[model samples]
Target: MLRALSLALATALTVLPEAAFAAELDGRSLSALWALPFAGILLSIALFPLLAAHTWEHHQGKIAALWGLLVLIPMGLIAGPEAALHALAHTAFLEYIPFILLLLALFTVAGGVVVRGNLHGSPVTNTVLLAIGTGLASFIGTTGASMVMIRPVLRANDDRRHNAHVFVFFIFLVSNIGGSLTPLGDPPLFLGFLRGVDFFWTTQHLWPETLFVGGLVLAVFFLLDSIIYRKEGHIRPDPTPDQPVRVTGGINFLLIAVIIGAILMSATVDLGNITLLGIEIERANALRDLIMVAVTFTSLALTPKEHRLENGFSWGPIQEVAKLFAGIFIAIIPVLAMLKAGAEGPFAPLVALVSNPDGSANNAAYFWLTGGLSSFLDNAPTYLVFFELAGGDPQKLMTTGALSLAAISAGAVFMGANSYIGNAPNFMVYAIARDGGVKMPSFFGYMLWSGAVLIPTFLIATFLFFRA
Candidate 1:
């Protein structure tokens, strides 16, 4: 299946006319049907695992590729070969490759580092662990922190029957809200960095919002967990007795530093560009990706195999992300183009919904609209769409429209906790917890939890922070 998908991509690159450069299709000329494949893929992701678990487990890649082709073929036929080729190359080289490489590097390095001890799963202990994980998320990324920390947290609470909420709150704080403080923490912020937003800009602008939301969420978790702990009684008296915590595979820390440095270097350095298959690839960005790949393999080679084995590290999560996001990137091409068309396109109602009568930018609308879409779609591109909608001038956004940009950034990063599909790490966390014997809530069941908790919290936050 992988070979077949590779062949299709290679054929598109080789045979399609390539001189048009990386150009998007004229979205106003396309009908709304262009979005059906994108919707199809999302539905497959949401429902198939529940409806046809064995088939989805075995042929998910093929399912993803099929939807990608559903868009690519029709798009090429309608838009002409050159534009289709340019779109494919642009999404692949400029967006998908970089995104996947960063995930690969962080997942590989973090997987190598094992936290080999359990602490008592008291309310205070769990809260402290969540806080630590949340803090680390901004530096090493939510995925990295989640991968490194989830196992120990699971181990710590293995004896408790009322601990599913513990992992759910972990998803809320560590996998989502904690990432709002820096570009390195989340893909949306990283995409902003790639688009010329300063690396520290998120840290500076989002600190207050992050603190308020993260602190509130953590407090709520502590209260909920304490109640559950008191009521549930003792389940089995610490199945995996607490031990002195020790961390192994210290070299992966150095590799993580290299990954961050590499990203910073790409953002700060101007290394010109090279044309590859008619796509103008930035040299610095290309170099960053190469370094990321090297770092991934370096961690794999240097870390003791026992460390990874102990962590229950497997390639399944990263592989699933890659295959699924490949389809998503392809299928989203037309949808984004139409969105870029603004009032003239199929998404005109959406554009109007987020705008004022006098045409001035509405900060609250930007926050909720960007966030609402990001709850279902990939947050990075959803962020980019709103960023462009608010005018894609980073300097202008920084100086004059700071709050609007902040709202957009915060919305994309924070509201990703709204659903499992909202952020990449959410599903992985859910899957890991379930596999470890936690009876996790189903898709809608999880949303009921998020709706009950996150919605009211976000309402308060929106009123306090995003109101004009």
Candidate 2:
């Protein structure tokens, strides 16, 4: 069954040209189909909450439903139901939004059930754990390592009422910035790989920037924590903590491993062959989707209820994510539409401005602008756009040296810590923290934190790594 689906998807992709029929709406030719979806996402973010208030009394669920509607209904309306059906027909199931939601759900379950530790440890211990978590983020994937370690990190700092900002900064560093080293660290980098960038290329050129930023963040975090620790005074360690550290249900880790493996296999596997009974069906992505689905369901089914109860797993975080992100995705559609209509117009000016300057100036401008926009927009696509603009082709640029690519990659990955919306995992970390009972900063409020904390550090990074 999966093989058949794979073949169908492969046929569709092969048949469809990368530059398909260009839609001209409102006197502009639509070059990128993704623009509408982006606009719908942004609009849905604002409208979903209001729509939810009227449709369902439960604010969170309303948000989720509104998000679903925003993403689904617009295509039906604009292109007609047939267009919507066509989209679904061509859309690879592996890339669908629901798959991410399922991963979140599975991680929530596993963290809640199988993982246990003292939610009340020393501030120093908490900071160290956070550093470890952040460092691990780049290795195992920001989301994967984050889900595995966030609960314990939260528990370690539960005693400090005044140190919520500590974890917020931690998220900025570990969950977002720390993932710059390798493709496995972030989805955007993985997409870059699929597009033909070498797998080890990032670490080779970008590792210096990563080390520079990571070291600075660690130093700053230590100083900040030390000062806060002194002011708060000390509380004796808990003697018989409510949730003692224990790893009783270890099988859940296997489930997480399966999900990660599925992601990797899906990304790397070729589905051009392996037909059964002589049906030449090529669905590489479909096979990956099936694997993810199977692992997610199995994880949910096998997780013990007692473990969930202990970990305080609830539907709230996913509900909130669904609601806001849906709107964000919808609202950005028109903007994307505009960009697509004039593919060169929106980004071309920036490229021209950068190219006219010397190498250092071009690199710095690229870093700051890309980093700044990445705060709100999806950094992955933004990275791709600037990356393409930086040099026409990576292979052709042997003479330009690798410094330019290094700068672009660093800006996209490291500066993503600039805002909560900068990366996917940023918000997830926020949600997990809030769920763990630490009230995080609001949308714009987080920006203020980044401005005060990250901007200066980034400046230093630019000078040492890119400028020097």
Candidate 3:
């Protein structure tokens, strides 16, 4: 099936008539029908595992491909093959490849570092570990921190009677909310930085909200976990015997620094552009991707096999992300295009929710709408949409409009915990925990967890911070 898909793509690209690149896809002209493929893929992800677990387990790639083609075929017929091909190529070269490579590099490098011992999953122990991970997330990325932190977390909880909730909170705190403080932590803030917002802006604007929400969630987790731990009167024998906790594979830390440097360099230094198919990609951005590839191989070459083995690292989680996100990146093209169209497009009503009848900025609406769409769409672009909607002036957004900017930033980063697919690390963490024998929730089941825990916390945060 992959071979056939590759052949179809190659055949399409090979036949382009060496003409000027087709005009960019215009979101305003697109009808809501363009979004059906994206919705189909989303439904496929949510439902297939429940109704046909075996088929979904083995054939997720095929299902993703079918949805992708649903977009490509009709798009070719309606928009012409050149435009469709250009859109696909642009998404591939610009968005999908870099994204996967970054994840691959982080997964490789961080997986090589092992916390060489385990701790008991007492409520205090678990809360402290989560707090550490939450703090680490802003320094390293959510993906980086999750890869480095989740194993120790799993090792600590393996003997607990009710352990799935621990990992669920891990996704909430470590993979999503923890990334709110810095551009280095998540893609959405990094996008803001590239658009000329100050590097320290989110750190300043979001610190209080981060503290409040993170602290509140941590307290709740402690209480719930205390109850669960007490109920777990007789726990299973520990699978991994505890040892003196220390860090191993120290060299991967430098490799992680390199990954962070590569990302910053790509954003800050524009070394001109190189056109691929119809898209113009920066040379420095290309170099950054090469550095990512190099880092992936370097980490593999330098790290001892024992380190990754101890960490229980495998290719499976990254492989799943690679396959699934490729389709997601493709299937989402129209949805994003319509979103880019803003007030003139099918999503206008959704867009309009961010303003008041008096034409004032509705900060609470901005927070929830940005967060709501971000719960499903990729948050980086979702953020960019609302950022522009709030008047794309860095100085203004930084000064007088700070609250609205904060709302957007907080919404994109925090509310990503709403679902598995909301943030990059969320699904990857889920996959890893599932592989490690933790009975992680299904797509909907996980939402029940998030909905119960996160909804109330976000409400309190909104009242304290965003209410006009």
Candidate 4:
């Protein structure tokens, strides 16, 4: 069975390029429609376990075949034959293939190269370290910094079972929240810079809010840690008193710097202007993107195995994230494409909700809703759509506001803690914790945590920072 699955995946990969090229020639409008079949294929894979459960008494192939027919027949009816065919083709190559490839690379590098470390200390000391780590994550990219530091923080508190919640909240604040001050800190804010929002503007406006919430979170964490610390009395000091307290292999810091430089160069460079091998692309952004790609791959190649070896690295967490998110990106592509095309179906109410209060369309509500969606969806496009909408001239009958932009920016960065699936690094932190044998909560369970902790904090943020 595994062999058949492997062969099927290989065949799909082989056929994808030609299919994409052909569809591109046919027309781009049909691309979204073309992606449905690939979605169905993925859906089948996701549902296989359920199918196997029900059909234990029967042939699995027959059940799968029946399920395929049920899915395809309706897809054909909804999309029409030719359009559905094109959507399937587009899905196979454009949507699913690229997504799967990107995930494979991302997880491979994370598991193979990044090291998780252990720190020994009191719970109070550990919580402070966690706060510091969160602050550092905002300066370096959240995932980049989190992957490197999480293991050590976990190790610091490893002996105390009751204090696991401390790490979970730590990820929420540091890995996700601490990075809001710089565009380089979070991808959504970085995307804003790419779209002409000032690099420092977010920090100037949003930093106060970040600090406010960050302080609140820290206070709560300290109080909680105090309780936990009392339960688990201090351990005897390490007998090897003369031995070095800090671990070595600090040189991996250079690799991190290289990755950051690569990302920045990619964001700023225009490759289209360079005549590389007679291909004059003329866009510096494109060239920068290429440079980033090269740098990322190069860092992965050159990282020492011994450094990663210390963490007991494995591919499990990233693999699960890759598989699930691949399907999510595909399923949501059509939804986003329709939103972009202005179909105005389910999203219309959201549009109405954001219409301005006094002759002008405020878009504060739109900013929040869009930003809310951005937390779970790709925050980039979510930011782009709302940015354009909020920035559009009111004379032209489009939404507009400076306050709206602030709301959008704040909403995008602040409420990203709303769920585990709300942002990329949220799951990365969860994965790292799970890998360390810390049984992090399930999706809704994490949401419950956020709802209790982050929701009121955000309300304070909206009132103090974003309210106009």
Candidate 5:
């Protein structure tokens, strides 16, 4: 499987057109029909598991491949082979590869380090666990923090009958909102960092918003959990009894530190570039990816097999993300191009939605527009699209356009809680919880939870933090 992926990537790189260098399609010339494949992929992700569970579980890869080819074949026919190859190669090399490598590294290393111990799912204990995970998120990335914390939380609450809400709130806080503080906390922020936004920019600007929103959510969760805890008045025997909490596979922590260092090194250092096939790969970023791959393997080599078994670590979640996001990254190219083209493109009216009638930037609109799309789409590229629309100038954005940038960043990071597909870790957390025998909400059911809980909180946040 790995060899096949390598071969496919290699072939695309080798055939990439030299003329395709940093070129975006002329969005004004493209039709809105171009976005259908991307929409199709998103809908398939949202619906197929509900509509055809068995088939989707068995053949998600093929379904994803079909959607990818749907975009590629039509794109090649309309735009020519060179343009198509260039777009595919560019998306694969620059976006999909790096995204997966980071996730892979985090998932592998975090999976090995099982949080071995137990505790009762008391309201205070659960809230404290969540708060710890939330704090870890900004430092390690949400995916990393989610992987490390979800299992222990699940185990801690295994005896509780109403524990589904626990994981739901876990997704709300740890998997999504907690990631708002730093670039490392979420993919959207990380994309901003790569685009010349300073590493500490988000940390400095977003800290207050992160604190306010996260604090409110945590408070609400505590009250809700207390209610749930009291209702279960009869004592039930703990399925996983309390063992003294000691972390196993401690070596993986060193690997995690290495991962963090590699990211920081890549961000701070530029060592020129090497042309592989037609794509120019940065030496620092490439080295970072290499280091991450090494961290993954080193964790696997050193961590005991029993540690993973206890954690219930499986390849299914990562494999699903890998297959599905290949389609998403490919299909989203034209959408992003149109978005980049601004008022001149087919999505002009949609673009207009985020701007005021007098043409000044509306931070509230920026929050909702970036967030509404991000709820269903991958927030990273959605962020890039809006970032480009708002003038792609890191310095200017960090200064005069700070509120607009803040809205975009906050929207992309915070409102990812609106749906399961909004972010990668959301779905992974869902799958893990479901596999562990928690009766997770169905697709629409999950949406209802988010709609009731998250949407109101977000509206309040927009008024408080993002209003112009």
Candidate 6:
């Protein structure tokens, strides 16, 4: 598989037209139909597992790749082979590779650190565990934090009769909203950092909103879990039985630190640019990806096999994520280009939604539009779109347009909880929990969960923090 992929990359690089270097793809000329492949891939992700679980399980990667080709073939016909290959190669090299590497590193490292044992799943215990995971997210990342924490929380509640709600709230706080504080917390925030937003800008400005929204969600989780607990009455005998929790594979934590350090170094240092074909990427960012790949292997090599086995770890979740998001990254190339084109593009009306009649910024529109796209599309790129729309000036945004920036940041990070595919970690968590016998909700069923809990939370947050 690795050799085949490497060969494909080589072929694309070798054949990329020199003419592709002469000009950029013009989004203003592209039709909205260009988005169909992307939308089709999303619908596949949403409907496949629900409608055709067995077939989807076997052929998801193929389905995703087909959607990718559906985009590329037409793109080659419409815009020339150079443009198509450029989009494919560029998205694969710069966007998908780096994005997947980070998720893979976090998932691998977190999986190696096994928390061995169980505790009774009381409302208080679950709440505290969720709180700790929430705090850890901004530092280790939502993916890292989710992988590390989900098992222990699941084990803590495995004995309870009615416990799916626990993981639902887990997704709410730990996977999404918890990632609002720092660039280290989520992909979108990290993108903002790379775009010149201060590493701590979100930390400073978003803390109050993160605090209020996270606190309210935490409170709601506690209350709902309490009610469920009261009704169920905790009568079920402990299945795993409570045991003394002993953490193994402590060395993986050091790898995690290395991961964090590499990311920071990439952001802080300038190591010049490396251009492959017509695409340019930072040497520091490439080095950061190399470090992440190394950390993934280092954790795997050092961690005991028993630790992973005991942790119930498998490669299925991350594999599925990588395949699905490859298609997403490819398919979304045109969609993002159109968005970047602003008023001259087909999405001009959608673009106008973020501005007032007087031509001032609309904070609420920024929040909802960014959040709404983020809920379906990947939040990282959605964040970049709105960030650029809101003037793309980090300094100005941090000051005069602070509220707009805050809304965009909050929306991108927070509303990712709106769907299973909103963030990388959400699907991974769902897969892990489901494999662990939690009877995790289906994709739309999970949306029902988010629509009930998260929508209201976001509504109140808009009223408080993002009002125009």
**Best model per TM-score:** 1
Against the unseen true structure, what C-alpha lDDT does each candidate score? Answer: 0.84, 0.60, 0.83, 0.55, 0.83, 0.82
Which residue window of length 10 is worst by lDDT in model 3?
A: 13-22
Superposing all C-alpha atoms, what RMSD in Å does each candidate have to the true structure? 4.4, 8.0, 5.0, 8.4, 5.1, 5.1
When summed lDDT is taken over every stretch of 10 residues in candidate 2, the lowest stretch is 18-27
| Model 4: residues with Cα > 4 Å off, grouped in runs | 1-118, 121-123, 194-198, 233-252, 255-282, 312-347, 359-367, 374-385, 388-402, 434-439, 442-444
TM-score of 5: 0.89
lDDT winner: 1
Residue 369, model 6: Cα distance from true site in angstroms: 2.7
At residue 189, give the lDDT of candidate 2.
71
Query: How well does candidate 6 match the true structure in TM-score terms?
Result: 0.86
lDDT tens digits, residue span 58-131, model 4? 44344334333432344344444554455455544433433333333333344344334445656577767777
Clashing pairs in 6: none
Candidate 5, 1-468: lDDT as tens digits? 534543453344433333332356766666676677777887887778668989998998888887787767655654467767888887777778877888788789878877878878899999999999999888777887898898889888888888898998899899999998877789888778767888788889999889988998899999999998999897578888668998788898898789878878988898999976577888998899899899889989999999989777889778987998888788788787767678887788876778888988889989998999889877886798789788778999999999999999999998898888888789889988998889999878988988888888889998898888
lDDT of 3 by residue, 4-28 (tens): 6545543544332322124655567
Q: Which ten residues in a row have the lowest lDDT in candidate 5?
A: 13-22
User: Candidate 5: which stretches are off by over 4 Å?
Assistant: 1-23, 434-439
User: Against the hidden true structure, what lDDT does model 1 obtain?
Assistant: 0.84
Once fitted onto the true fold, the runs of candidate 3 whose alpha carbons sit more than 4 angstroms away are 1-22, 158-164, 187-201, 226-240, 373-405, 419-449
**On a 0 to 100 scale, what is the lDDT of residue 223 in model 6?**
95
lDDT of 2 by residue, 233-288 (tens): 86545433676667665666676566556656655778675543333334764566
lDDT of 1 by residue, 1-468 (tens): 644654454455443233312375655655666677788887788678778989999999999888888777755654466667778898899888998898889889989988888888889999999999999899888988898899989998899877889999999999999988877799888778776789899999899989998999999999999999899875777778668999999999999899989988988889999999889989999999999999999998999999989878899888998998899889888777767677887778877877789986788899998889778777876797788767667898887889989999999988899998888899999999999989898888888989989988888999999887
